[model samples]
Target: MSRSSTGDRGQTEPLAALVAVSVMALGLALYGGYLSDVLPGNSDRHVEGATQDRVWNEIQTNGVFDESTDIETVLVAGSTGSNEATDLPEGYNVYVAVTRVGDDGRTEVVDSHYFASDSSPAGDTPSDGVPDAANNATRPVPVRESPGDVEGGRLVVSVWT
Candidate 1:
């Protein structure tokens, strides 16, 4: 009887281990599938927010479109990559624009910088002056024309992947 009981215990130990391993593997497979389906959608939002943050930081740091500064000079340099302070993610395009609002609240573009990409259609400009398909994030920054001048406008940043 003692010999038989000892043999049964040994077999049960291996069986329990096998069942545990199988359950763990199934759980892992399900989790991986869930991530594959969800990650792509969340990634776009992440990129949008990140791009907005980068553009805002650059404008604040470089004083772009600020009063007493040459808008043309700053815009030219920024468009040519000389004034780019942030490193964007792969396959992303950024368009920065400065707009001024009139007394009637009508806004006009003052200066703009567009970084075009050859590979993605998202970087291409449409005939209607809008992106055909892309994710965009825009932020309006108040410009300072002069000391205590409320004649400021907005700085728009559009990021697309």
Candidate 2:
């Protein structure tokens, strides 16, 4: 017969392991919550609809697109990046992409591609054609596509998720 040194030593090992594991799991969860906002990655910058509206407002204030025109639209991008995260596929939606044509026969497009999931430590790019701080979430460059047979020109903004 084998003899044990401690009265409850046999049961103590499992209990200790359980407690250790529980603490580790809790710590990991808390870290994950913090990392979600602080992490530097594409998913971190996924913009939402309201932010898009704010960007639109900034555009209106900055005079990016001519609101004086009859047509004005704001593109709300759904995809964050190329991991298949959003409910909608990452592709261009013409309705959201805004374009304007002046009486002088000049065609202009204001591309608001990003629509950030969260507003963490943000960034801003400024230049003649660059988006202002308010519109920083959106991509800077504009991609133009012709709308065949459509009366007005088409503004296309490519998306990936």
> What residue runs in model 2 are displaced by over 4 Å at the alpha carbon?
1-12, 39-97, 100-131, 136-148, 151-161
Q: Give the best candidate by TM-score.
A: 1
Name the lDDT value of residue 90 in candidate 2. 29
Q: Can you list the residue pairs that collide in candidate 1?
A: none
Worst 10 residues of 1 by lDDT: 118-127
TM-score of each: 0.55, 0.30
The RMSD of every model to the true structure, in order and in angstroms, is 6.3, 13.7
TM-score of 2: 0.30
lDDT by residue (42-131, candidate 2, tens digit) is 363343343344444433423234433222222223234342223322231212345555458886553323322232111221122323
Predicted structure 1: lDDT: 0.57
Off by over 4 Å in 1: 1-17, 36-46, 61-92, 118-128, 150-154
